[model samples]
Target: MERLLAPVKAFLHGETPSSWIEEARRPERLAVVLQDHLLCELKAAQTAVWLLRRYALDKGGSERLKGWLRPFEDRVYRPCLVKEHQAMASEVTPAGLSCRPDAPLAGPLVEKMVRLIKEELHHFEQVRTLMLARGIVIEPIRASRYAASLMQLVRSGDPWVLVDRLIIGAYIEARSCERFAALAPHMDEEVQRFYVSLLRSEARHYQDYLALAQMASPEPIDARVREIGEAEWRLIAEPDALFRFHSGVPSAL
Candidate 1:
């Protein structure tokens, strides 16, 4: 815990305002935050699935990948497709995942990615359970601009391909961790507890993604990480049109 606190303390000192914590702890804000939180988990799972399919797997493997997510996508992921009062009670399990020749990936990369997918899916379920308990209806909202903006910077082809994707993943995980820390203190006890519990996992996920990026690429990752980190910091600090979990400082919406 001390090791975790070292970085988080530095992060909080540098990026978060003191008053923000007070504002975040209010019980009145939990519903809105939780709604965003739930959506964020879905998006995380979706992002991991997309990355694995695009970079690590072959066509047949990708189809199998999509199959793993199809049930959730059909039921819980796209909220607009289902009745407001109705929720899917069954859970989908991903099975028989293995590397393919057309896009052979390293074992460690595959293992880490598959584990992340499972964790993200589990988190999606947890968020759904919280929403059900709180009577927070799941609705499709327009995605925040954070991801699209970062993706626009991805260089086309080969080495850049892996580097850019991994950089984006790091940014996403970092931002999610930042927001969880930012919002947790101001939330109701239940929500605060949940968000606080999430801090360690999210922090580790960011590191894991960054480490994988470094391992996959021959180029030095530090400079790339620094460059992307600066860009991410701008996205977070600047005014924005939306207020999804990863969105920048809320504009007048």
Candidate 2:
């Protein structure tokens, strides 16, 4: 546990608040937390797809991504049977998706984004299965302010916009990794194992986003990274009314 804390501590600007964990550990709240986590994984994949389509891929690539998500989107757009979601999730694979060689940062961006989407979707499937086993209905909740607030800092330009997005992605991933590590010990056996299992991929996702940011940027992004990191810290450390998976301390509490 001490060893795990090292990387998680360095990854985020601030720790997951103790108040947040206290609330998260309650049995009454577990379902909501897990459901939010399950969908948050999908949201991460959507963000990756958006980045790929917006900056890394051509029209064909974008269309292929749509096809890839068609199955899971149906599950979220409207309530579907659990078996239907399972079957559709089972069919998600990156076999047919390939990067076009003609775009900016095409190779690294496509490669990493594709891998991220694959893993994130896989995680979504895993979480859904866990939810099913626990008799929790998979419901689509509205997104929290965590991601949107971070994205508000994104500038308006070509590579500049992409650079900021990538930086934001890094912060998001890093915070996810930190949260998993921080909350793992407080979770039940099944949930704890699941959270711990996610640490490696989340850690890699942060690094991949940072690497992509550097690749997309004209110059060094250390200063920009620090700037975004601080913003992320504020979001984590401050009070929030909504208590989704990545939210800060609950205001009402």
Q: Which candidate has the highest lDDT of all? A: 2
Q: What TM-scores do the predictions have?
A: 0.83, 0.92
**Runs of candidate 2 exceeding 4 Å displacement:** 1-5, 81-102
Q: Which structure among the candidates has the greatest TM-score?
A: 2
Candidate 1's residue-wise lDDT over 21-79, tens digit each? 43344555556566766667767777777877776666766777676666556545565
- The sequence of per-residue lDDT tens digits that candidate 2 reaches over residues 1-253 is 5565566568678888999989889899998998899888888989998988877676777898877766665666655532353434445445555566667587787778888888888898889889989999788887779999999999898788999999999888888888888888998898999998988888889889988999999999999988888999998889999989989888985
Clashes of each: 5, 0
Q: Model 2 residue 39 lDDT?
A: 85
Off by over 4 Å in 1: 8-14, 17-29, 77-95, 102-104
Model 1 CA RMSD to the hidden true structure, in angstroms? 3.6
User: Distance (Å) between predicted and true CA of 149, model 2?
Assistant: 0.2
Q: What is the lDDT of residue 36 in candidate 1?
A: 67
